[model samples]
Target: MKIIGIVDTTFARFDMGSAAVDEIKQYVSARIIRITVPGIKDLPVASKKLIEEQGCEIVMALGMPGAAEKDKMCAHEASTGIIQAQLMTNTHIIEVFVHEDEGKDEKELAFLMENRAREHARNVVDLLFKPEKLVKQAGTGQRQGFEDVGSLRG
Candidate 1:
């Protein structure tokens, strides 16, 4: 199945574009996309193509908690919950990545957040996207050209 995905870079804390895709590609083969809010709001042309032309089946909205305080349990708990999509109300996954202030560099923190969001997205896809679709695959599929999560290869 040809699928279009959307990852919102609304917050600057994490790499929403790449990080969101990292979680999804592990579960299915699809044409993933990442769109920034500013670009979408400012440039109608890009939004038209991304929203109208591409025909994204599922838009996985991604976000990082702003301000260290907001990154507490509240944001983390929010990510592991159900949320409606922005563009297509009934056809989006509002996935979020939240990091804790445990004394780590931005890189390390981002890594942890990305992995958490990736797994969280998987749960969303399995539970909501295609309930009957079997995703529990044997073997890593690494030798078969299927890279691990966070890979850009097709």
Candidate 2:
């Protein structure tokens, strides 16, 4: 059986990692490994360790960036680190970041967190089991949280 890894931050108000695991369970039979860290920057190392030490095939790194300039900067740095981890391991680390500013209220933010994490969880299933499903939708403007912007040609 395959193993999926989820690395999330405790700083996030919502439990996006649980949302992801719940979603993944609906579509796959793979074992899931989850690691919770204190902040976004800690995601990459945990993700790397999941792949290297825990033998995960793919990882989902989830975080929520606060609505502040410094938070945005930290998110960017975390993104860079996630990319580096992916390249170093030659594996996919799906970074799911829902900025606090994305929603106008707490309810909406929670919705975005669940929606984005679940959507990415589906993407992980597609990647591991049926990559052609994703290829079939390429350039179709598929957004995870908010409504898709739609294809430019359409």
Candidate 3:
């Protein structure tokens, strides 16, 4: 049986975490253990504990960084920490962050966050069960909202 750990932050919009978890459940049959922290900066240690103590195979981290310089800096630091945790545990952590500036309005931001969370949840499933799906995307530069012009030369 596979176990997936989900780490989310209260600073993010509420729906993002739920969306990711829902999407993950739709594709894989795994026991999901969720941990909600107060902010993005708290994810790394929680993620490490999930992997080392909770026996999770993979982790999905969800957070939203506000449109402020400080927020961006904090997000960067958190991301680096998560990478270190992944290396230490030899496990995969899917970090999904939606910056508030990515959208023009609150509605758009919420929509984007939800979509991004779901998309990354699918990524988590692919990484665990169907890695080939992701390998095929290498160097494609294909993002969620953009068209894929893989190796196309004008």
Candidate 4:
């Protein structure tokens, strides 16, 4: 059986990790491990630990950056760290970040959080079990939280 890690941040108001778990369970049978950290910056190490120590094949790093300049900067740094961890581990860490400012209201924000998490969770399943499914959709402008813009090639 495969192991999928969900490393989320407590700073996020929505339970994106749960959304992801629910989505993944719909497709395949894999051991899902969940880890909670304090903030976005902590996602890299936590996800890395999940991969290296906990034997996770793929990880979802979920975070919600506040609607502020500093928060955006921190998210950027955390993203960089996530990328580095992925390179070091030679594994995929799907960064699921929903900026607080992306939505105009709480309802919209929650919707985006859930949608993005669920969509990425499906992507994880594809990466683990069915890469060709994703390849078939390449350049299709498949947005997670919002409406897909569709492929440019008509």
lDDT of each: 0.51, 0.97, 0.87, 0.97
Worst 10 residues of 3 by lDDT: 145-154
Q: Write the per-residue lDDT of candidate 3 for residues 4-101, one digit (tens) a residue.
A: 99999989865677887899889989999999999999999999999999999999988988889999999999999999999999999989888889
TM-scores, all models, native as reference: 0.52, 0.98, 0.92, 0.99
User: How do the residues 1-154 of candidate 4 rate in per-residue lDDT, one tens digit apiece?
Assistant: 9999999989999999999999999999999999899999999999999999999999999999999999999999999999999999999999999999999999999999999999999999999999999999999999988999999896
Instruction: Give the local distance difference test score of model 2.
Output: 0.97
Q: What is the C-alpha RMSD of each candidate to the true structure, in Å?
A: 9.4, 0.6, 1.7, 0.5
Pairs of residues at least 3 apart in sequence or in different chains that clash in candidate 1: none
What tens-digit string does per-residue lDDT give for candidate 1 at 66-119?
546645544544443323123433444445444345316677667666666665
For lDDT, candidate 1 versus 2, the one ahead is 2
Q: Report the CA-based lDDT of candidate 3 relative to the real structure.
A: 0.87
For model 1 the local lDDT of residue 152 reads 46
Indicate the TM-score of model 4. 0.99
Question: Positional deviation of 104 in candidate 1, in angstroms?
Answer: 7.1
User: What lDDT does candidate 1 reach at residue 28?
Assistant: 72
Q: Residue 142 CA error for candidate 3 (Å)?
A: 2.3
